[model samples]
Target chain A: MKTHLQNGQVIDDSVPQGDNEAVAGKVVSGSVIHIQNLRKEYASVAGVVPVLHGLNMEVMPGEFVAIMGASGSGKSTLMNILGCLDIATSGSYFLKGRDVTALDRDSLAHLRNDLIGFVFQGFNLLPRASLLDNVALPLVYSKVSREERVVRASDMLSKVGLAKYRDSRPNQISGGQQQRVAIARALVNRPKLLLADEPTGNLDSHTSHEIMNLFKELNERDGITIVLITHEVEVAAYAHRLVRLADGHIVYDGSSHIPQGDNEGTMSKNSTESSAAAHSTS
Target chain B: MISAMLNEAWNSMWANRLRTILTMLGMVIGVSAVIVMQAVGQGAQQQVRESIESMGSNLLMVLSGSSTSGGGVRFGAGGIPTLTIGDAESIGELPLIAGAAPTVNETAQVIYGARNWSTQITGTAPSYFTVRNWDIAEGAPFTDSDLRSVTRVSILGKTVVDNLFGDENPVGKTIRIKNSPYIVLGVLSAKGQSLMGRDQDDVILIPITTAQRKLASSQVVGSVRFIMVQVRSAEVMSKAEQSIVDLLRQRHRIREGANNDFTVSNLTAMANTAAETTAVMSLMLGIIASISLLVGGIGIMNIMLVSVTERTREIGIRMAIGARGRDIMLQFLLEAIIISIFGCLIGVILGIGGALAANGVTGIRVEITLSSILLAFTVAAAVGVFFGWYPARQAARLRPIDALRFQ
Candidate 1:
């Protein structure tokens, strides 16, 4: 029998357990997200191609979740849905105890603006605006007063160790510093969920380690739930929980405290259908 | 919120200063053209009005014949000698007649102190000066006794005095006209030029009785060139003109529909025609100049499209920050408005400066009215809203995902 992990407990894979009750029963309050049977498809010239097939996931407040998959494993599509940038084909998504699937585009945008902060792989800062202005951008949509916006933005920049460079533009800073600014911008609105897609994708390994450490620190001290997508094991090593997707289904969802060498073996065995994931990670 | 949008718009424009300036130039030139055209038109009309006003508003001229030239071979209104002094005296007796002058214009060579000059010599009663809105600058005008006695007294115009007497006063001096010595009575004030381009001050005034009896013997004794009549009141001018025409036709024994032997032209009618024509011409020029503003608006639209495409990534960034479509639209719309308002301000300065320069350089009259400036500015703002909406809409419609992925 396959030994699968649920809520940090080893269970038999033959049990056919419903994961929603297991996660919801564990954390009664502060349940940030609850999704069941989430399916996503794209209309291709050939036909409708499914990317996520009946995916079920649950994330409690303040938990750092790292989602790992190779290029065709639908990791980016999953991040898009979780960030409210997209909708699923047919599924129920309750974010912060509100039915997100029933919301319209504008309401979804409002929810995204209010409850989620997005960090892209590219550190997409408006090139012409100063770091202070960039960090205050989300508050502009929220109609925050100028004095409050500046104060809150400056406070976030100080947390990222970029307070001195608030007046400087994005291009004037280094790549690592730009990502730090992006992080500051993400946290300026005090979003409950921080969604970062390969936040350190363009950085060197040393800088990526520094950035991931910052994520861990923020998750621990501030109790901010973070979900990051990455294809690199080293980048994913920072998260407490690891969820691996293969062929549009979750192959493994467990604590990532297992040895690194053991992960290579499990990847090769579990994602045999997608040899790309095993080879890319190894 | 608006302040935030404005600040963003200002920063984006500052990023491409040269392109912004180039775009502004189109509207500047457009608005300036409109103002200059309107100024010149208004100035020309004002000049026409001043000239017409100097001719005495209620005055009427009784020419010897109709204005239409027979068979299209044009003849001056004074070509026929059909009017007589009797016609003038009868017109003067009417209830509406304030005064009458039978004027005869003939060029004469005058000599004074070996300096001789040829100028127009007008012979009429003293009322001619009043009817023509002329004030005597030196000695008094010749009286009716001077007209009946066929006296050799003459009133010299300012130009004639300047040329003939230089700085000296010629009131008591003698000037020779056709070798007949005449005493200078008064010097007329400068009247500049008439609407017909005739020099009003380059002439002399003498009695009509003397002109008929002394200068040209071939001219009949009873006939005069034309009759200048000033109506007692403006309200009675049309009635005055009608009664005079009827009396003239009766004296000349003309039957009904038999084309009267004379024409009566009133100053108000002539002034209205000239003023209307000038106003219409100005409106036409104003309309033509405004077309350039439309072209400027198109220029704004074209440049904004390029800006929208160039800043696709920025649009995506803003959208990701939870900006609604209207927010993106407002940013661009504000940008276009700033350009338009800036363009209008510069154009107004240039337009007023150009009008003044035109007055100095080309000597063309140009009036800069407050209303035209306001009108031009309002139109420029409207142009901003009109041309700006499309490009702003295009930006607003962009999907955040697609825009971020754009290179």
Candidate 2:
């Protein structure tokens, strides 16, 4: 299947075109993420539970994409693989043209630090650290000098308009402000890709829009590639393209403006019934 | 990276002030216990060593053998008058022997004008001072002429001088012993206490001839109680002892395979045994204190494990933000080390203070050596690393997904 971008670019999943160097499993040069035949599984007492089955996708540089899925749809698993937080059981996943599956644990960590930034749903700031230190946390692992780390982290904090609260801890701020701090931290290292997993899940609708607007501004103004995960249609509406997952498969992959009632109806119905079943069994 | 981790560790510890201090309490108690116990034990050992040195080096005591009475009742060693001034003189001439003094001691009442005290009176030649390493603090010791002329001259110990003279200089003053007036020749310096806990300074010395003729007139002439012999050095102590034994046996005309009339005892050997016992006691105290250090280490491990579990979410967040396993491990490990080292610092201060207080209150000698402080620090640091390893590894080995999922 071919997924077309708003900027007149096409992501062909079948065969990558020119600049695809086949030197020892190297892929097309310009794609930020290129995954082919990706699969993941967990071994349980009963049997093997497969979460992703030979999923193929590509994300070009500077594109904003949102992944939407019901509960148990394996979207979280795919996001984890893209973020380099987990290794696929069997797959050829190249992040920034380097085969991620072939890298060791430390090398993968370096790649994540250099290439991708993560914003979790919980706005996971180190509660004990000041906001400046929280934003500077990634640079600590990146071997940045202390002076430079503070400079860069404060610059990012000011960009997110939380400059005055640099010395404030996470608990001292409101929920929207905390998410803004999380965004500041995510952008501090100048990573090429921002992988936000349900970044606004904990906020009310008004605050969620504020955080979503911050993500949109970071994507458009700084040209940072963003792949956000969420089940909320309004949150996904900000992204130019959408990938919807159902039962470990991408049921719809197209423009985000497609009527949500038809797509979300089956997804939300499946989630509600499954949740009801889970509740009754428990 | 290390500095940043240290800062992070410090912040976390500061955030959990109560828990950090509670964790450090174990190490503090352990290190202080080690220091105080070592001080006390080393102080005891030093006291034993000083007492040993004060008795004179390489000394041997030759005591007269026990005597069997009419009904086969045996008197103990040194009960008979077999060791005499003649035997002591002959022993002094031996090649390995440094000097020998025939000594006879008895309790007697000493009287000065308006003051009188009962004290031990030792009768011996002037060589007794050199043989026993007794120094004269003031005036001059009596000479050989005094011994030969049977002069009624005496040397007073510090304790005796304090009692009889008060503030007066006893030298050239007359003191009455058994109603006979004797001129005080000199005063001996202070010798604190003997190994047997006897007051070495509470004595008076008189000429052996004067003592034999005037004081103990009922005894045989030239007979003495025991002979104090000094060897040249520690190396020839056994040789000198054997030579004295053989010479005494031959002099007393004891037959082959028969016990001699006198027994030679090595004082150095007895001192060595006492020193060894104290050394063993010191070592035992150190070991006992080290057990508390072991408990402290275990306490660190226990608290670290709990910390790792509690901070799993933080570890997950750090890992998500590109922290490697080693980074997480180092963070936790640094926290443990900081706690222990700070605890050690406080413990050293408290231990030294406690040792000084013990010395002040109990009047015990306490030594707080630099080596012991260094030892406590190193052990505390080593304990921190050793116990922190497993919990740190447990935190590091956590999967990012699993850790993030931990509540």
lDDT of 2 by residue, A1-282 (tens): 234443323233234433332322647678888887788898999899988776667788888899877788788999999998889999688888888999887887788788889999999999999999999999999999999999999999998899999999999999999998998898888898999999999999999999999889888988999999997878887888777666565555666665434463243344333233322332
| Candidate-wise lDDT, in order | 0.84, 0.85
Colliding residue pairs in candidate 2: none
True contacts kept of each: 0.41, 0.69
DockQ of 1: 0.56
Q: Which parts of model 1 have CA positions greater than 4 angstroms off?
A: A1-29, A36-54, A88-90, A101-109, A246-252, A257-282, B66-76, B95-100, B110-118, B133-141, B153-191, B229-242, B255-259
lDDT of 1 by residue, B1-407 (tens): 89999999899889999999989998998899989998999998887887787777788999987674345454467777789887888888888898788988899899999799999998888878877778999988999999889999999988899899999989989999999999999998887767776778899999999998898656677688899999988889899999998999899998886776688889778877888999999999888889988888898999899999998888887777688778899999999999989998999999999999999999998999999999998998799778988999999888776777789
Query: Per-prediction DockQ scores?
Result: 0.56, 0.71
Residue ranges of candidate 2 with Cα displaced over 4 Å: A1-26, A259-282, B67-71, B217-221
Q: After TM-score superposition, what is the CA distance of residue A42 in candidate 2 from its true location, in Å?
A: 0.5
Can you list the residue pairs that collide in candidate 1? none
Residue B31's lDDT within candidate 2 is 94
